[model samples]
Target: MWKQLILLAFILANCSATEVKKCSDDKPFPLAVRVLNCEIPPCDVIKGTDMIFEIDFFVMKYVTKLTTLVRATSFGMTIPYELPEDVRDVCTNLMYHAYCPLYATEDVTYLFKFPIGNYPEVSVKVEIYLVDQDKDVATCFVCNIKVKKGPTGNTTVYEIDY
Candidate 1:
């Protein structure tokens, strides 16, 4: 009888824990992450063999105001689906807001331009995983993006649903 009561209590406690909503607690911004088209006024002048893409990630926290910004170490490819790589160089060097406050929004943009030797199709993806400072462990926010390469390369917007 005691064992049954303990088991029930454990189950209840586990179920009562708060489930982290994807990107919701972090910010009030649009649930959908939209990357607008890449446009350079004079299409002719901006033409280059290798295309450069800009990616921005916004952080919105719903819980305690976060004080530290975990340095992003790596990111996974979205469209082509490649393995994760060290993106510290791209993120740390070019981020506007490295760290964000609780419930506040911060944007980080990376200039991703790769040579188009054989691969014509261009797709950019950045997955953001939240790390707990105290625990020093990673949390699965499970946020990812996959943007298609456009013909004109004017404005390529990728909308991340979920």
Candidate 2:
């Protein structure tokens, strides 16, 4: 028993002596876009009609949270936003959100609301990244949204560690 205790103490000491590198490095809180009451994307729309949308996101910067970028691409579709200038170095190694319809590339927290007119069933991809690219690590969180149209929207929140 005495030998076991001594061995445990030695291990503990070594662990304490080792230096830990924090990815965030004492950065302040980050501004994360809080997507709330997001309704299931609306059904196919007719051409020449106007659609209005409202999006919400919380922006806090320097916060220790992950930010996501939304990407939309197709074989022959003209996407509005070109890829950002900085992500070319690590785009291939990106991890993506399995269910997000759009893919993301930047670290910006965006609440996007746009009108969809005369478009076919469009598919999207969502990807997230660590704001500090040097860390070479990726973290992702899952959020839930429900929309009831008109005036009442239902939503649920979940916390995940990555």
lDDT tens digits by residue: candidate 2, 39-71: 233222323232221112222323333323333
TM-score of 1: 0.27
TM-score of each: 0.27, 0.23
Worst 10 residues of 2 by lDDT: 50-59
Give the per-residue lDDT of model 1 (tens digit) for 34-128.
22232321111122233333434454433222122222112343333232234323343234454333233544544334322333333322333
Which ten-residue region of model 1 has the weakest summed lDDT?
Answer: 38-47
Off by over 4 Å in 2: 1-38, 62-71, 75-78, 81-113, 117-162
Model number with the top TM-score:
1
lDDT of 2: 0.31
